[model samples]
Target: MLVYSFQGFSQERPLQQSKELPQRTDAPTNSQQPNNPNQDNNEKGRKTLEPRPISEYKIISVKNDTTHVDTALTIVKDYEFNYLRKDDLHLLPFTNVGQTYVTLSHTFNTTSLMPLFGARARHFNYYEVEDINYYHVPTPVTELYFRTVFEQGQNLEAFFTTNISPQVNIFIGYKGLRSLGKYQHILTSTGNFQVGFSVDTKNDRYHVKTHFTAQDLLNQENGGLSPQGVINYLGDDEEFDDRSALDVNFEDAENILDGRRFYLNQSYDIIKKNDSIQNNQITLGHVIDFTDKEYRYEQSSANEIFGEAFETTNLRDEVEFQEVNNQLSLTFSNAVLGRIGGLIGHADYNYGYQRVLIQESGTIPNRLIGDVFYTGATYNNTIGKLAIDGLAKINVSGDFDGNHIQGAISYPLSIGSISASVSTNSRRPNYNFLLYQSDYVEYNWFNDFDNVQTQRLAFDFKSKKYVDASLTFTTINNYTYFAANGIEVDQEGFENPVTFNIAKPTQYDEQVNYLKLKASKTFEYGVLGSSSDLIYQNVSSDDEVLNVPDIVVRSSLYYKDHWFDKALYLQTGFTAKYFTSYNGDGYDPILAEFYTQNQQEIEGFPIVDFFFNAKIKTARIYFKVENIPSLLFGNDNFVAPAQPFRDDVIRFGLQWNYFL
Candidate 1:
């Protein structure tokens, strides 16, 4: 079904102001001047200067919620110490650092109103506007993240931010990774560069944030293992202990995804309210976003594994998608009414290949170009101890038909918080599913699909004293997916070589009901502690269009203590993750998408890892041994149909922060 883990909600929340830190002036006072002879000698104080608190450095989200920088070395920090710099509890990485991840879970809440571009697998590390974070700091701050990759490369992310003036801030950062994997023709290289600035007017009447990002993700694909290689790998033969010795489908194939984006958001106060009084305030806001992206796959020669091609050599498939959007909004806020806003937006999108394709069956159009106008409203308010938020949007006039509505309510409990939400969406499928042209003759397709409609209701409870749990129920109509049509070949000498297939887009005409329940908890006893997360899912459908594991679990046990007279903090732990067996989706390197397959059921296996982490001052170091179980018991883990999991490996990394 080409389903992957969609993280986070699409709804925008009300921006919250952060508590201001005490301002410290760098200029010396007249009394402290060396020429001031009247200054008391005793005032030449021997007091030691204390460093600024971490809370003075703020990180701001697109929604305007602000949080300070955290340098602490906690278990959560250890979990986030990876190539993506995010917790991978619900994800499984391939052998290389910059490669795509296998989604162990899925979330349906999406923010984009338009159809997304293709190459969905390569976009996990791609940063969107909402993924970017702004910053405010008392002084210049620098952060560096470094980790070792598979074979001969390293992954690093460096960021620096400073305030140009009291009201202006700027930041620049770059994350780069290059990994030569242990397997044949599986190298990955990627980079992301971002520069941004924020400005606030002295009168507090105007505020703006702008950023530009350029990114490229490249991977050399081998189309997984050949049949003989799979047989050798499954046989656990000692001669093939070295992965490089194994045979791959093809060696001269690669794909690249590159994009550039410019974003700007600004707001002006039309009716300002004094801080000392309780009154209504009004603001006018505008946002502009533009992005141009392309995905290309090239092969030295057409391989028989993917079927016949129009041309046998030097095959290339490329697609492009460009979009620009502008929005204007007016908001009013009060102590009682909280905040209410209305917005109108216009979007222009163009997606397709360079030229139209003329085939015997029909003529495939080269482009889908259109403009859309949409209007939406947002409301956020607090009545007594309960908070409420709602958003609704619809396409007023456009070639595309889409709409979204969401509502949420939350209440603070004595220990934690309880929240409930409901959301519904109707949108078109991705552009790739609609129209595509490839060098392979069987890969060309054009289809008119209906808008996919979905609805979800969820409840969540968060607390440390009690278990953190969530329950969600969702229903989907017009589910679209990719399926394979197999073509068997009979050879005289070969014992029925692996079957080749042509993938096609298909839609189910029935409703799918899905329910999910998840829970997490942590327990501590002296210096030893354990944390666990469990998920259970059930899917009910008349047709098998969607598939996922029924259950997933991750648990970790650790010991923490301060060593060397509290000079260093240390934490050591072991984590294990497991899921039930299911018909895992197969990956298509040409399209860079996962397609549904039921030929074989992949048995779930547990992946165990050991980690040792230590914190000294502002630097955190990590050492880990991943996939320990694979080392102890022969290697039999596979993330996809033909993709094998990573073997045991020792890796280390560090995160350091500097305040200047």
Candidate 2:
């Protein structure tokens, strides 16, 4: 289904984890039977999947499409299972959903700070984004989601699919979460899984897709709190109410990340099906893609307080990475090639092999090998309702050498859609940033940096009824990060006396700019509904090496009805979020990275919530009370630079579906 290279390889890279979805995406399976796809004729025994059009279903983003829809429109959102809660729930707002970041990206990176285990956010390969389906269904399809809060936080998702015949179609999926944090030894757990199949080949020209994915992310590094244990663990007296009994500054720190991926995407159809635009319908294709991946990070226990990060002290911190990809494509389509509607194209070549394994504690025991090649193309167009997308990439040797490109445009209004894009990125450097051997001492290095550029521009608009807006700008040069000029004075000398911190990895030589603005709106009378979101940002070398938070706000108010007679359908809401102030970065679970902190700022805070959403007859329910005035504004919030999110709690959840 080069169906337009699925709209340009899902926007080509940068940003992973951080997620959301499930207003309803039927996919239930308890093992039903009969389906379609994978039948190029097989003597006419299978051939299904055509009778779809509920406005074409939709679930795009098997891994690309630069998904964006949630400037706070609220749904599910119980703080999306908290990865360090920066709010914006479904992720991408100060990242974390399995972690990986270069902050606002335009791809081309290798200033690796081990975004959790690097490879740029667990990419082993298994991406999907082709929605609206129904080819054949008279049974099997399942979905079940769950949520819980304060009971040690949790967020779970499920999936199942059917159709083992009529060609083929199969499925399985899951998303998991765990949070046992109330400060003091905070903890987090994550899991992701996927299973797949798709086909259609009995002459309808060929199409194939396969998937397998598994991910595990774990974290527990409370090296913060403990400047007297944050007033003895959020004290207001009451003996700090046993807040995990306070006391943190690495009590045996921890971090773990594991991943796996497998992929196969196939397509074939090289014109001549009675050409002549098939009487006005044109298409041409050829594609073969395969991928294999693995990423690992481990740290069981080791801590000395930032300065020495980890070199021993009993050792235990590992890193492993592997990647393999092979892609070859040539696709084309047209409903009118270049002026009004329908148009798709992609030209490509990507072959890669990269490996890295480094065990720690005095270095040496390393394994590194590299190979790469690249060429790229992607384009999509439709002029009537406006649509545009374009992307490019280049590399000839080693861990991302150079070149990247991006462009996007969207227009579809009557209710929503407005988009824009621009990008330019130059790379080089990321084989652990040109050699890393770790004996601690700031994790050894051998610098010679240069060539790291960026230029970005963006604009967005969305409205289904009210409003949604966005604007962004970025510029950078050299600008790598992970900084420090070292300081550890105490006893009236001030400086980082508290829980000590120091950093390394720097690269900045001027040129840094950023600007952002966003807005959201929702309102409904009658049954009552209200929503609002706003954000503003500006950074020009922010306090020496960028950190976010200029302003952010969210508000929601609701009331909906239908009970008993309607079998249930109730809703109630109140949500609030506020942001302002900054001083980002300060996380080092033994070099897991997020260093660079200036004194301390993290100011401006506000959080409030009260929800009760319901729907019976297929299940969907959520309840809330996060912060609820924190028993009346008790205060203790910090989404980074010492992590604190998760205090006043009481959350609930459930989601169910099964279409036979």
Candidate 3:
């Protein structure tokens, strides 16, 4: 950390020139010579009595200096398990800790030519606990909680480029990143450890880029009970199921940590650059990524703890998955009648293969997937004074199949003071939505992230006026739903257990709707000026999307130039969330056993944050306060013992920059 303290700061004044900028002209000409000598009657080129009084014409020119506008430099770091409290979120640091980049631009012999360069670095640590709620019984029990995580990451990139002409330039860049992580957890008294490393590199140039990535992960588990192995103790008979007990006994023997590697390369180039006359363009892109994974697990138990020799259950298993993906896309467009935009078309093709093997049994499962998409659209900026825009897409894939179209028209009104437009669009399912696999495992873990349905249609209307107010209304249909399986089972007498199904996790076909309103205003009052923005979103879902809220509102306020020679500023904001219940048909089998009949509704939560800043010539300082009230909310969906309670922290930092 660095600190900077300064006093009596003076602002730098800009230098001025007496001469004015030269007038813009396509060609240089003699303005003093009139086309018609008789009309001007100034006696063109005629030397009169006293040297014509020697009229002065000063064509003022000044050298333009590079202004380092809005250059920012800062050090930021934080520890976060996940964004939005999700289990699948990968922890990354270094370049992810809200780093600030400083940019500098310079212009010489201006033919509208400018060059820029920038670099940044950031780092942090993250840890999380997993599988505490369900283990052999399908999930780890809260009583069996344990910590498992270690992560470190670093990323660096520097780029230099200059524009030869506006919208056309050449660039050179270098980028590199690395990630190392480790995790530890206990199942049936055995320790499970996982460690991994990843590295990535990228290079980019005009109209083309390339990327490469590699990763390796290792996992190990020991001292766990194995299936068909000796068992000494089991949990109380009340909450424990025999099958679950068997699972715990075999957890260690079934535990496997595998390593995975991935590589990707891609490029984009302009096959044809548009010209002034026809405005034609063609671009092509290609990408390929491959992955290989292998895992092994061994089972062990403490059979001789009490001196008596007991049976030993040893099980060994190994699994591997290999995947390769390739994609190619080509686009073409041509202007129409050299007026309204003509036609644009694109085609994309993709193929992928996945192979899985269970080493112990020599069993293999393989799958092949292919995809294609074709799209075309037309646009006209000026169709008899009415700006028009339209887009359409058709997709064909193993998991996705649909067509989407949208169109919009807008024209300036009331001397350009206000403009309004309405558009309608439709969407199909994502590539992952069509495939439904509840038992698929990834990265040697059984965690799942999936969606039920796809978006079918949407209509939106937007209105804006320079900057006073903005309003948007959208109606959506066939919205997807992701519901966790909710279940209930009788814990009493063995025979005929009565099961009450709660919420079946399914992508229910429903109409989801939302409306957004935003307004902002600028006032030049106390201290220099102030700006405020308010936004609201209303959402309705057919089924409870776990932790997502139905209504959200955000508001922010800022006060500046109040102290320290106009160097200090303050910002404050608050967010409010409201949720609704899930509406589905029945209880899902996967969730039926983990939940109780009486489901509790989660209450809304409000969060507030405050920030203050001070700027100096070579340094900047800032202080931030988050979760001011420290409110604790509860949720039963998470595997952790406690929902993320209110978090309160204060942070202050300073940054300095200098060039050599």
Q: All candidates: CA RMSD in angstroms?
A: 7.6, 22.8, 18.3
Location of the lowest summed lDDT over 10 successive residues in candidate 1: 1-10
TM-score of each: 0.92, 0.30, 0.45
Clashing pairs in 1: none
For candidate 2, lDDT tens digit of each residue in 391-417?
A: 676664554466777778888877888
What is the C-alpha lDDT profile of model 3 across 273-384, one tens digit per residue? 4465637655454545444433334445422211111224553334344444454545454454322222222222221124343535344333324333433344435555
Report lDDT (CA) for all predictions: 0.85, 0.55, 0.30
Which regions in candidate 1 have their CA more than 4 angstroms from the true location? 1-49, 489-493
Ranking by TM-score: 1, 3, 2
lDDT of 2: 0.55
* Candidate 1, residue 183: how far the Cα is off, in Å: 0.7
Model 3 C-alpha lDDT versus the unseen true structure: 0.30
Best by TM-score: 1
Candidate 1 Cα deviation (angstroms), residue 100 = 1.2
